[model samples]
Target: MVSLQIVKQSNAGIASLPHGLVVLFIGATSGIGQSALQSFARHAPSPRIYTVARPSTFASHESLLASLRQSNPTATYKLVEADVSLVSEVDKAVNRIIEEETKIDILFMSAGFMALEGRKDTSEGLDPSMSTRYYSRLRAVQLLLPLLNKAPSPRIVSVLAGGLEGPLNEQDLDLRDPNNWSSWNSSVQATTMATLMLEKIARENPRLSIVHWYPGPVDTPGLAKIQKFGMSFPNPMSQEEAGERAVFFTTSDRYAVQEGLLPVPAGLEVAKKSGGGIFLLNPQGESTDNEAVLDEMRRRGVDEVVWNFSQKVFTACNVQARESKDEL
Candidate 1:
């Protein structure tokens, strides 16, 4: 476990790194994403930060950004309005970023939730929870690959279940059948599919350091919601600590594919990558080996299956959005 002290000490070095580091954050309105964004904005030197938020959360997020700017006057924050649960919306958000930035050094994604209320499909025929967790997140990465590749050392940090991959319902990757669908199953499918897809992306873009982190249980608004369902974890990590660790994962060389960001902290070695390449990290910043399930999936070419399926979903979403627009 990388101690909290080490995480904070590493993060303090961010100010020394090159200034104006361009970062794009998806789902930074609340919880871990919000905390991580605050941490990054506080330390990074003259950072250029872009965050996405749905209409409902824009005002509040703006207020958050206002305080961040006050804390670090050198940083610039732009909040793009878009509901990330929709792939089309994600494209629109990314396009906005692409229009202004030449390259993105870091793409931090933590926009997701547990569908404790059950499946509620969006207009594009996707469960909002699954879409936010897997489909939209992957779509954003696919669209931003060109920009990411241009960076000296690009990194993608996905805050979700990385080490906790489980059996996937391959027959129903989307879990369309009601009988096969449940909150638990949906979460599993999202987590498993995310790992597979990220592995594929990592292999294709070897320079990009992708960290899929399972931050265990964090005490946040999301966790509070879960508690309402009579489920709670004992001694959940504080959001501030989680945020510091997240920044460590984002900037510390310990998780990097190449040396560019903050150097690995003393007494620590570079974290190990999965069989297919990206870092599957546990909360303590240690690499996890879930090859018992991942290796077989890779051997069976399940990653490709996931990649292809994801593309079709993106295509379908675009078509649906276009048709809907034409109707008006």
Candidate 2:
């Protein structure tokens, strides 16, 4: 486990790194993503930050951004109004970014929720929980790959279950059947598919650095929403600490394939990437090993299956979107 002191010390160097780093945050309206955004705004040297918020949250999110502007007057903050629960909206959001920015230095995503009640599908005919956690996130990455490759040390940090991968129902990839779908099963499927698909992207784009982190029980508005479900943990990590660690993960060279942003600390060596080139991290920000589950998935070419299925979903979303426009 990387100690909190080390995380903070590493994050402290954000101000020294080159200025005007391009960063985009999805689901930053609240919770871990919001905390990380605040931390970055406080420390980064003139970062060009872009965030997405649904229409319902835009006003409140703007208030939050106003505070961040006060904290760091040099940073440029742009909020794209879009709901990430649909791939079509994600495509629109990334298109706006692509038109404006030449490159993206960091892409931080923590937009998702565990639907305790049941699976709720979006207008695009996708489960909102799955769409937020998997489909939209991957859609954003796919659309932003060109810009990310242009950056010096591009990093993608996804806040979700990383080390915890379990048996995948290869037969039912999306868990479409009611008999196969459950909140726990959906979460596992999302995380497992994410690791596999992300690893594929890493191999294809060797220079890119990807970190899938499982932040065990963070104290945030998101968690508070689910508190009535009778869930409890011994001690939840403070949001501030999680934010600091997130900044370190985004900027530190220890997590990179090539040193470009912050330099590696004196005693630490660059982190070892998983066999597939992605970093599966635990809550403590340490590299986690989950080959037992991943190796089989890869050997069976399940990664490709997941990718192809995801592409089909994206294509369906586009078709539905176009149909809606034509009807209108």
Clashes of 2: 0
Cα RMSDs, all models? 0.7, 0.9
Q: lDDT tens digits, residues 1-328, model 1?
A: 8999999999999999888889999989999999999999997899999999999999999999999999999999999999999999999989989999999999999999999998989999999999999999999999999999999999999999998999999889899999999998999999999999999999999999999999999999999999999997999999999888999999988999999999999999999999989999999999999999999999999988888888999999999999999999
Report lDDT (CA) for all predictions. 0.94, 0.91
TM-score of each: 0.99, 0.98
Model 1 scores a C-alpha lDDT of: 0.94
1-328 in candidate 2: lDDT tens per residue?
Answer: 7888888888888899889999999988988999899988897899999999999999999999999999899999999999999899999999999999999999999999998989888899888888999999999999999999999889999999988889988888889898999989999999999889899999999999999999999998888877878887668998888888888888898899888999987787788788788988888878899999889888989999999999999999989998998999
Among all candidates shown, the one with the greatest lDDT: 1
* Candidate 2 deviant stretches above 4 angstroms: none
